[model samples]
Target: MAGPSVLLPLRSSPFRRYLLGQLVSVPCSWAQVVALAWVVVELAPAAMGWVVALQFLPSLLLGPWFGAIADRYDRRWLLMAAEAGLGLTALAYAAVSLTGGLTLPVVCLLSALWGVINALDTPARRALVPMLVPPAQAPGAAALSGTVMLIGMTAGSGLGALMVTQVGVTATFTLNAASFLADVALLATIRVGPSPRLARAPRQIRDGFRYLWHTPRLRTPLLALSVVATFAFTFQVSVPIFMRASFDGGASLIGTAFTVSMAGSLVGTLVAAARGLPGRHTVARANLVMATAMIVTAAAPTVLVALISLTVAGVAWSFLLMSVIALLQTAEPAMMGRVMSLFALVLLGGTALGGPIASALAAAAGVRAPFALGALAAAVAVAIAWPGAVRPADRSSRHVTTADAG
Candidate 1:
């Protein structure tokens, strides 16, 4: 079998162009998150949890609607609109804060709106990748996308922290808003094939959900992913509180932790891009690695130690996420938009349902408990994948490799 380097040339220029667009926008989103969270802490200290919750609320409420939109509309325009909306929302946030009239309710509304934009943007952005990249290089493209996202996140988080401390909250928000304009420019430059044409069938949304539900392999991976994300999503959501309560650290520490984890993500994506996992077995192996990392992360006693643990977790995270993406993309190229919409819905559900559970658990039982339980959930999910790991016909060495990979 050939390695990823051998397959590198398969992707097109448009793939890289789109990737660059994401590189600009994703980090912008993360920077705004850092800014928003910090502002909430400063302005409405007691209701920070609610503010964070508002950020993800749109994903939960309108995820299916967004998925339908991804299938129904031209993805390029959808992505551009989402990026611009998010940028404008950040400006709104800045305007309120600069005027000394910022309110928690207003922040919540803006955050929810941001969520709506994300809902529309995420599926379109994801669905476009396979169309741009060749089938052989899809895994590499996914890894590259993950790498860009993490890199952006690291820079944005770190920069937002510095801006808040040195400049002010308003400056950080303003820069975040600016990042959207830059994203729009980059997106405008990328020319992709026309999006798939959908039929004007009477029950299109119902058909999308039905198609997803009936596909066993798709259903299985999505279910497993949901279970895993339920716990894993907590890392981003509750980490700020963890920094504040456990280490008595501030935004700088939060930024550093994210940066460190993103470094791990870079490592993971590079490895995935260089080597590539060829089969379902490889994906399973990656899931085991992810499960172990999460367990270790949950068990860490100190913030620095936890950060190190998160680095390992990040590697596992990227590998598993990419593998799942490759599997789904390979399975349904024609309906990539619909398949990814389902993927987006599952992710949204996991984050939305899990965020509050994680928050309440962290608030009540301490930060480590929810993390530990999350790790346990991951382990169990991996265990569930064991039965489908390999086929009976592959009872030889090839079968063994397949089983291990799964």
Candidate 2:
């Protein structure tokens, strides 16, 4: 249902290039992800959670500092440097695997290294959007960005599985390594106004935290996200565990259900994109829908019903995420980098924690327990935030800037 207005952001040449480049880069990245997951699951299923945790731990530990860097430096250069690092890492992975040097410990180390580069890259990439387009189109741009990930999910998952099976892991890693060069090229062509170069202050990161803590419009949505995102958004780790435990990792069934969920995410993104930005109450509704889907996934007696529920969950989760991004964009442009970095912080931090939490809960209870716990946490958080969520979003600017407190 994305109409002409929804496509307005595409008219920006810089955004167009960025979107197109990501179209190529994202799927490749996804292919590597699937290949990597396959390696972990096959080699040491017991270590999957630790591997996942290592892969995202940098985001939790180093995210705010990198976000400060994003606020202070040219995002384009930072992104390019990250891509270069990614390419090197991918080649290293391919070399190690092809030479039969791949192991659980090596994988953990490599995952951690990648996480460091990603922690730096994520905030910069996220904060770059408003620079590419006008503020009003931020919602549409946000929607488009979501599409990039879904597209990756759609193409990347299938491709990843296929390549891992057919072409072998080294080829898959090499393929993704090549994509980074293309990304770097595209990023070089992008034109933008100067990035904010904040002065070297000791507490720049703390200022970001303080700004987020005080801004009700900013704080409430993230508060809801802290719960929902920590639980619902960790599908990558949970679903895999679910498949391995419940269905014994039936490849066809997992693929079918995962693809269905991606389709649902596609639907969710379109609906949210069409609506522009939803109010806070709407976000609460999305939470309930997602919680319901997770419950259904937990309780369904048959695979058919479980698959259907995942699709629905995907729809609701994607819908809620659009609002999260759009709401975050409401922050002042000067503060946009830090705000988006916090968004990444909460998001990736949840991801870092989600894997271990899912593994522990699933081990103690049943495989389905993580989904149920996620549902309960999300519902409770949304309820607590509901009162404030009903308030209309404040449109007035806070005049917050990175100019050393004026």
Candidate 3:
């Protein structure tokens, strides 16, 4: 058989359908994010940070449990139900906006609810990717997924800005709600068989942790990722504030900045896809690049310079994200759901913890403070990861035990 090509995963009917659904749904999610940030900034500028934190709070609390559920249940049904629930939540937000009853508190409530749905969906969706393609194609599939998401985000942010400025927030929310429904429809067509059943085990969630503990190679990189996630991913909280406070720009400019960033992300994803999955040393190097980019972004004197810096940051960020995920998937195939959940927990939980700090820093020092903090955190992650990256492959390979084998 021929080795997997970049487009090989798309040839699978189930994966193709899932990709189509994501192409629509991810853009809507991005649009909603842009709209929600704008809405909070307009209604209660003081609560913007808190509102952003709320979106990730559920992931910190429920990620592990939900990941266990993904391992135990039918992922397709879980994903479908989550998509439906997301649609309802979007509709509720739209109704509130259209009725002139939208408030910061309401927005926060809805965002938390949305976060809960995501906590369930994310692990299941990730776990299903391997099931949809041949093992050799998994890396290509992951890259394709990342590329599609970035494309959606790029278009979605721009569309969201135009909708908010011209058609208003109500329209933006309504359109997002529709997109979820569309995703649900597409999901219904994917004809994958049920996942293999695992034997019921005591302390299933703890088992995932134990597995990680026994595997030093995986543990080191994941810990490094946790640090980076805490500091670097707080951009969602900082970007809007920076645009409004520092640059004196509005939604359109915010959307344009996001577009540029995602364009860079697309480039990074394509590079990783073409070259195949990166190893630990490459991921460590990507962290340093990300740190440099963040520092440059923080120091940018003009909006133009900031955008260029953000683009570089975006590229580095995408490379790091894809590399980490590919590493996790490659390391543990059987416990993928639980492992990925742990990954999600570290990343989202870090955001939950860091969002408020970033917001407070932005409130006090300036909007650019978080980027400086992110640079420091990234440097720390690089230091922690470097030794692991240089460790002998023979020793690292031996760490994969029978327990981790499928």
Candidate 4:
């Protein structure tokens, strides 16, 4: 903040402490992600897609169910439990690798376990923000949450890649496991009021769909977003293979790619923010940029060209995703949570749907094929969105971040 007046959210001790925990934990998570891919590639390159699928499957299958559990329980405590579980999961992952007992099957099991822990954690984590602060400062907390993750990405990927090369993937896993303990400890120190027992009716899910189907404005953009997500979100699975196949690069190279790509994402996000509220055709425009950039990235002749294009893709992705969430916020206030939930499923959980397919494309067609697939999917998104609504963005929606959406 430029001044004390601008940092109201930080005044809340609970929220501040929580953010500190995230600053420590999120980087380790990214480190684990970078190392995990390399291990899978080394063990069974063909099965990387399966690993991707297992890693995200729980989010697709259990998100709503887990969200309900968060509503019914004390979110802070639930988050603590989930974090502890994740730490243990990471430890188990490290142990297997250290003992030379890591196999494809073992990796898949741990990946699935990690996914389950994340699914259990997300709703609680999202809800805990508001609980940590007053409503007036909730937006600030939400905005900062994304920033924390971006900072983590910037630090973690470069360091993780270096660790993969210098020390090995085993150290990355161990550090990540250790990082989770910090979060657990920090979570224990923050106190919040007891949550009321909230019961969710089963029909709410059906009703949310019914509303989306009837609302043309929300319906069309979501459809387009769905198409784009099915391809674009598998960057980790695709890009590592692209590095290996195209440039004979390894995990450290993958980390470098992620670092540059995320830096470009930060630049893109700043550009979008500088423009203020998303203008007319924002979503359509974002898709067009995204598609074009991904195609270029897929076809680049050299590592430098591909890395530049990857950065551009990252920029487009921020604009594309943030705008969609903003559009979702324009829905009726009473149904906002449900609508957001729908967006989360399509945007984040669809990783399960896309990961396996993209991996198979990489394994069979060529490493460049997955990014090319994204380009095609993004082109479809452009087509679907171009003739649709003007994509009116909610003013409040401007603060949304890709991390929060995830």
Count clashing residue pairs in model 3: 0
Better of 1 and 3 by TM-score: 3
Q: What does candidate 2's lDDT look like per residue over 1-406, in tens digits?
A: 2578999998999999998889888888877877887788778665777777887889889989998898899988898899889888888899999899999889999999998998888889988887888867777888898887787776777777778778888999999989888989999999988888777788788888888777777778888887887766666677777876787764444555667787788888888888876765877888889888888888877777878888899998888777787777777766777888888878888888888888788788988888898788768767956788734345455454534332
127-213: candidate 1 lDDT, tens digit per residue: 777667655566567767776787887777777778777888788788788878988888888787777756555655666566656
All candidates' TM-scores? 0.88, 0.94, 0.94, 0.87
Candidate 4: pairs in clash: none
lDDT of 1 at 83: 85
Query: The CA-based lDDT of model 4 is what?
Result: 0.76
Among all windows of ten consecutive residues in candidate 2, which has the lowest summed lDDT? 397-406
lDDT, each prediction: 0.69, 0.80, 0.82, 0.76
- Checking candidate 3 for backbone clashes, the offending pairs are none
Task: List the candidate numbers ranked by TM-score, top first.
Answer: 3, 2, 1, 4
Candidate 3's TM-score: 0.94
Poorest stretch of ten by lDDT in candidate 1: 394-403
lDDT of 3 by residue, 139-249 (tens): 788888888988898888888888888988888888889998999999888888777445667888888888766666567778888998888867778888888888898
Candidate 4, poorest ten consecutive residues by summed lDDT: 397-406
Question: Candidate 4 — which residues are off by over 4 angstroms?
Answer: 1-8, 131-140, 192-197, 211-221, 272-277, 326-341, 390-406
